[model samples]
Target: MILRLTLAAIAFAATLAAPLRAEIAIQEVTSPGGIKAWLVEDHNIPFMALEIRFRGGTSLDQPGKRGAVNLMTATLEEGAGDLDAQGFAAARDGLAARIGFGANSDEVSISVQALSENRAEAMDLLRLALTEPRFDAEAVERVKGQILAGLRADERDPSAIAARLARARSYGDHPYGSAGDGTTDSVTALTRDDVLAAWQGAMARDRVYVAAAGDITADELGLLLDKLLSDLPETGWPLPPPATLNTAGGLFVEPFPGPQSVVLFGHGGIAFDDPDFFAASLLNDILGGGRFSARLMSEVRDKRGLTYGIGTGLSVRDLSAEWMGQFQASNDKVAEAITVVRAEWARMAAGEITETDLATAKTYMTGAYPLRFDGNDAIANILVGMQMLGLPSDYPKTRNDKVNAVTLDDLKRVAARLLKPDDLFFTVVGQPEGLTSSE
Candidate 1:
């Protein structure tokens, strides 16, 4: 009860605080052991959120050991050092701290929040979880059961089926192609050793990036970094190579008996660091930016009533990206819906956007940008993310300018380079009447 109240207070405080301005300074600090982190110091509320991200997340899984890293990450809080799972939870609650561990294709992330009064104890607890995760047999088995259950559920989910099929077809034999959670056979066969190996391969100093917001100083953060991370191994496993994308265009249908078919479509996308990325973003917005006003939603859902929602995005990975989108329509309407999408895709490929379209997208993107920094925790994550993306500290100040700088010609250039209608592929999952597998 006390822990809940403390956390609620932090949330409440964030609500009362003013939105962070772009001119706010981000200080980069390095620890005694040479580990570096970004800091945004706000001493107002006696609370702080610390985020640690280790690059090369589940992509570092060893051959035949898929899901080991994911399972290891889940078990970090199960037990550590002299503490059991129950003990760890009790200790964290006692400190009024919230600590979480997560993993995705590109990184493993650790988040910690604590009040100023109990910060040292919270850090010590986190240090144990990182350095000495027990991964005991009982705990590992329980967590494995949970993962297996989720995998079974994924089999029945239409959206998951479409996404999995798309990944398999688009990125054959790459880490990107396979499920992050191991298949039933692979996960069932996993032993305790694999979990420990995954721990060593994933959680290490070399790949770590850190960020903090609120109630902390650079000097104090330097000491905390060493105290928290110094005991871990210096390096982890090598990151996987870039995905070899199959950019070929086709419509492949997987027959699942459902009233509606879930469609996933895309081809190659621009790189994250590309100079024209801002233009690509604007183009995607005009085409299908998950908003009701975007072209795809306007054409397919609003006018045609084929589906409730249809949206698109750039699925950017470490060294790869794909222009991706998803939508659902009844089995009968799937063909018409897809036809309309392809028409819109081809239309965008021809650099057919208006001045008004460009201006509205720019206004929306630039206007909504500052609201992202709504609270200290969000700002902390943004700081870490900017560093990971190789963005400068002053990026917040310049981002609106960058968004507003793209002229019509630049958008057209990106549209010409990207938006390949011939290369677009669709993975449709359901028993639709007209769609079929094509090459």
Candidate 2:
């Protein structure tokens, strides 16, 4: 009776403390020129931040024009309107504003941060960067050299080699198989014309997503957005179709001169729109997604002491989605590590989750979920991403409930469908002792 009373007192204290945390406010804005954006205002700070993303990412690269979009993003800041690279730098410093641009596998992003006192001038500078970019050749080459250096450096890292080989084996002949940062061969061959054409083809108003946070009113943001997106052409290029998932059986080894082997293996998984997505996320949490209280950690760390860490998740992109799991262990334990992974895969495939396991997973997933909305920038970013993925406005409010609703039967079904040990693609990098393709 005393222990029950103590537990009740602790629960009461937690309930009382929960209300002290602030909730994020989400507001949608549509510009006069029809550009829509999500906004979150935080008056606590004296500065504002704007983040915008476009749809045509690395997946949209044409055959021989690889890395063109990345080059465009890099060069856009070099010159714009009447300002060359040096002139633009002077202008930015004059207003004490910061701006940057980059592209990823699924989207290209532009971000700016400025003081509230100089919001208008800062925004105009952003407008010039966005709508009047010059795409200078020298700037393009400079960025290309930086990328080449990274590619060279990555070759020496066993983890990087393992990841690259895994994708190549999993998505053969598909654009999604290629690296977001183009290969050394492809990037070295790119020209100025290719960069310009890719910019004109990919960066369009129709494919844009905007997000802002800080000391700005709705009216100010509306006007700023109009000025920034005004020069975009009316139509955009059609987005390429989604990537295909290849589950054919294959294993490859990239023998790196290292003592450890970085092993990566998984198969096709569900899309974001799948009703089973929330359930699948919870299932992954139980298996290997969580840092603690996961099957992989228990088996690989606590029992065998093989590796220090393991991870699993859905690798979601605009063109494709896949279930991926990874681990690293010493060369001597590589075979043992692979065996544990396969056993866990088979165990999940056979639907063996216990009541205790399910309950623990649910608590980990739901209890920590609210932390994602702790700040204005995080909230704005989440809203913008959800809009791009076609998720509902109420997604954040209902996400935990959906996760809580996933059952043992749901996990069984998703696991059986997604976990394909027979068809998995394996890539092990480093000089693992006594390791073979068969293992």
Candidate 3:
């Protein structure tokens, strides 16, 4: 099955590379009720993929109710209207439709895929789930239990511990600092009323972004949007204030019994719409943005075998932005790895980059763009994300041009302005030799 999926993905990528890149068009559609969406019409396939994102997400959780939004979103499809949890699942399965609801710190997303023949039925089911989710006590407890179990598991996960601690230190008391899944105690304390209120506070029309692809016309998509989402509240809870990173350059060490220590290090990042974003992106690509040729991988892993891998990239969120990286190494070597990382960070901050690095990063980024638009589902998801990021519809066509336009001078300028070795904070989880907490 894995091999089959791999081949299917390759074929889909090939299709996108051939004619789709040149011919794909995005149309803006506004429903009669004034809700807007981006549509990509493709009649070649009889199925449509619709993606919707609500911006407030778990960040809108009421004070002392950290996990309410997450728990509420998870229970959305569990039961709604006349359908109980089991009945809802049965009805959805009966039509061979796919529907999913999920939430993270920044957004709550819903994705649905349905054949044109059964599209109406599928939409109706989705409408029921969104507009009239039945937060029955039984279903609520079941889902809450699952979330609690996950939280328990996360407590023992070294990576999860590092991430939670890093965010907590970075954002302080802001909502972004808290775990989206909440703590075991928070989930346990949740009541059904809290769940219902979370639905009201997080899911609403005003904060929604929509994208649709395949077997759907603008008019049809507009109508579907109204039918599925018109009943939601006009607005959700007020948005959270932007969060600022509070941790200055330093190391925070949490002692744990393990041979390997996980390190999370980062500093502030640029916004998505910044003019120098492309340059910053190329800089990151050359530094540690997933490619094996990245400086971090080549220097840390290939040259010295400090760890199996290492990477860094920009994380742009609605309320905050960060440039972060992570890697794990044996306790005996973690201090050396940190020394190497600090040297690289200082080097990059001093604008030590070459024309060769710029050209290579740009070529790889531009060449890999089309591979991301492999199918209707992928495209739809990308469209909604673009909308959320305030990108113009023509971004897809001009994105590579933007990447190609970055000059060696541009990269150095942005690197000097953006990279902050002095502001980088490290959160290390596990006992390591010769390292002390800067805190």
Candidate 4:
């Protein structure tokens, strides 16, 4: 009784001590041509970093064109405006500017950085890539060959195969189930028109949300944005509908010719906008997000001595997300490791988190939040991400409060919603002893 009271007191104290504060300040402005953006001006550095995210990403791939978006993104840098692949690379190297573009499962992002004195030229270059990408036939062929080579190489990696199998089994026919990079067949069939159409969707100003940080003012940034994006075709973007999670039953095994076995397990998880997202985040940390302090490390590695290390994460996809817990161990112990994982997952769902466990998870999440903004590039990237996700401008500031708000009850609820062992599509990609095929 006395111990129970002490624990209760501690929990109450933690709730009071580390409250979350979900405040992020954003300054919105309209470009001269009516293009809008969210800004957080900081004139501290002598460089400016800009990140623009398009509403749709890989999920926009049409049927039979599974790698269309991926190929388009890869092709964008091959040539743009008047610069062929080599020429584009030369110009980037000459300016000493770092420019990169990528597409994820849900959004396409372009990151550009240049010296403040050269913002005009940099923006001009960025605008050209965004608008008048050359997409030379030769460059497209080169990128396609490279992608096919990588896919073939990846087929030999057991860990990669395991991850692919996990998502494939979980999502089934969903776009997330397919490879982000196009397959040999898909890439071979891709045409120049398809790339152009994908590009058209990505460059729309309304569908684009630009975030700039570092050495630039709102007014100057606005003008630059106008100068860069004004000439682009005004085709409005229609984001692909969000993906839904499917937690159908049965384990999935991808037999591979390897010594060690890779295992992945989890089911439908929290969405970013779920009010219980903070609770889910805290739960993930206590369970596996913390490599050092998580239950997975302590039980799976320290006590059982099965694997070197294990970690889990809750990924917030373009709209929906999944909680995937993954690890690798010797083939002999694969079954045992899986058993322990399922048990712990059930335990978490049964409200097994103690006050101390909750406090520790919250502390880690809250304290580590600010580390995401340690550099100008990181800040610029996050600011754009926040906008894309429709999070409040003050999200960074108030993040801790939301994390602290997670109660034991909230954790239990989210855990139950997320941890579906029977429904979990476990994929093992190595030759595990005594592991029967679950296909």
All-Cα superposition RMSD per candidate: 1.0, 8.0, 2.8, 9.7
Q: Candidate 4: worst 10 consecutive residues by lDDT?
A: 14-23
TM-score order of candidates, best first?
Answer: 1, 3, 4, 2
lDDT of 2: 0.77
Candidate 2 regions exceeding 4 Å error are 1-23
Instruction: Judge candidate 1 against the unseen true structure and give its global Cα lDDT, from 0 to 1.
Output: 0.90
lDDT at 424 for candidate 1? Answer: 84
In candidate 2, what are the lDDT values of residues 1-439, reduced to their tens digit?
Answer: 4433443343333334333232456678888878888877766655667888888677678778777787778788887889989999888777767688888878888877676777798888878877888777787888789888988888787877887777676676666776878888888898888887777777888789988867787778888898988787655556777677777765666677766889898878778898989878887888889666789888988899999988889888777888888888898998888878888888988888887888888887788878666444455566778888997666777887888888888888888877777776667887777766643
Error of 4 at 279 (Å): 0.7
The whole-model C-alpha lDDT of candidate 4 against the native structure comes to: 0.76
Which stretches of model 3 miss by more than 4 angstroms? Answer: 1-23
TM-score of 1: 0.98
Residue pairs clashing in model 2 are: none
Pick by lDDT: 1 or 4, better one: 1
| Candidate 4 residue lDDT tens string, 77-111 | 77788898898887765665668989888778898
Pairs that collide in candidate 3 are none
On residues 259-296, what C-alpha lDDT tens digit does candidate 1 reach at each position? 99999999999887999999999999999996799999
Q: Give the per-residue Cα lDDT of candidate 1 at 122.
A: 95
Clash-forming residue pairs, model 1:
none
